[model samples]
Target: MRHFWCILLAIAILPGFCQALDIKGVHYLSLQEVAGKLGMKTRWIQQDKTMQLESAWTKISFEVNKRDMTLNGTRIFMGYPIVASRGRFYLSESDYDHNIKPILTPQLSGAPPGLRHIVLDPGHGGKDPGAENKSIGLKEKALTLDLANRVKSKLQARGFRVTVTRGNDTFVSLENRAQNANRLNADLFISLHFNASSTTSVSGVETYAFTPNLQPSTSRSSLHSSDRKTYPGNARDEWNTLAAYYVQRSLFTSLKARDRGLKRARFTVLRDIRMPGILVEGGFVTNNTEGRNIGSASYRDKLATAIVDGILVYKKTLDRLAK
Candidate 1:
């Protein structure tokens, strides 16, 4: 069987400690193998069908039959459920490659990436109001701009050159947004938006990076079109993924909202970015409870603060990688 050959190939090629298992023609690695790579301590809780991986600063918990795991209390999707084999738990090869590696070991590139200049995009402007919550009269455009102003101020305090694509209630096309950032020679690009769902109950923070080449987006509906192209944005896919995670975690801490997990999309703003880029949908505007929060000045300030906190973590990681 092809699967059997894959298992043989993995064992023959990988270091002895890996203990790789092939499942359905793909390889998965054992908890011990992953723990060794990440320098984390692993505890197997057989009764609860859980494995806890802890490091000096964080603890991550994974459970069988679940596609999602908790990273230091912030929920992150694994892209596929981890399975148990002969009392050892395994992480899917795709999940480890597309999800875990980027978040934990981001700077795989020989040269380190920096975040010296940041471009903040306030999604939808003059002509395009984007999603809106009619009950509270909150338009997505105004909210994003307000949040961008605060974020710009925050980033400036952190010693980064910060600029927004739109300074007022003006329209800026997606291509223009990317071009503006490129023109500025930005080191990072962050596009901000407020989400809306048809279902009123849906509310959470979602962060997105351009889908990697030969990979599908997190949402199934996007698969067909996403298969069409890859871009320069893929150059620093690892950095983009880690940056998204840092901000997603910080947003959870500041907003106390649901962690929707880091996602992949073929967003125009991201696809053409020569530098690392991410888009943040802070929360759903359609949800009445969250709509009010998104409309508040205090909440906008917190959003800015969360972004700054995330960027700080990302910069620190870059510094460590450079050394």
Candidate 2:
């Protein structure tokens, strides 16, 4: 383990790493400098307080003081909001390491993981019905199970080994869910779920990976002492970011739904997982329209297709990197 960290430290100080500025003790990198290092040309939209970096294969847009950014048109939330000082915008080094570097320059982040076996976890079952919309008769547990089965079928058809945390409406502890995957020696883990909100109008799809050490999750604006803690799942932080990004992008594009953006969270299942994993909030079960949509078999099939597509894309990315 000490040797592993030593190698990571060596990589962090490489030329590709940003020149960091100490801002309230957090390290940050100038947006312009980041763009230059990535071989992207920067353009500022002063009126909108947005800066865009474009290159032959990538386009990223960052807004001053915002945690959400667009990478090649996919919405993703940074660990910290962009900081502005002396007419310049800066991104947290944590964001660069966990989000940007993994997506744009994955090879430098680390070696790509094998993509052969996958474990699909349906979020809740049995007594844990999870989120529900009684008005529309939609239950998150049932929807997740259906979606997981659909995804499993599609994945198996594409020649990948797949396992499910549960085959029916049976309760499985969160820790057991992850441990099952580890025991199976799965290459990837995906937990499927539906969302709900007190506000009925709130609706969208979002994906979550384990939060990087010392970085706040998407829902939090400030870091907490607990943010410094690392877990077994953090071992695959780079791959988690990459997988979540692709899955979120594919879902938004195929479903034509609101892009909630790829997010970070320390969910129990994610924190205990031994391999790259993400928990997907497919949509809101409480939203009137979306709730009805989740009840439909065709929409569920589409969601499965989009998810399978994303996994294929991620696999292709790793394959390309290996060569």
Task: Please report, as a residue range, the 10-residue window in candidate 2 with the lowest summed lDDT.
Answer: 1-10
lDDT of each: 0.83, 0.90
Clashes of each: 0, 0
Candidate 1 local lDDT, 1-323, one digit each (tens): 64466456656884454367775555788777888888999997555499998899867788987777877776766545778865678887767776777777666545778778999999999999999999899999999999999999988987999989999999999999999999998999999999999999999998888777655577753236555566888887788888888998899888899889888878899998899999999999999999998899998899889988998998998998888
Top model number, lDDT: 2
Worst 10 residues of 1 by lDDT: 220-229
Report residue 243 deviation for candidate 1 (angstroms).
0.9
lDDT score for candidate 1 against the true structure = 0.83
Which model scores highest in TM-score? 2
Query: In model 2, what lDDT does residue 146 have?
Result: 98
Deviation in Å, model 2, residue 76 alpha carbon: 0.8
Model 2 TM-score, 2 decimals: 0.93
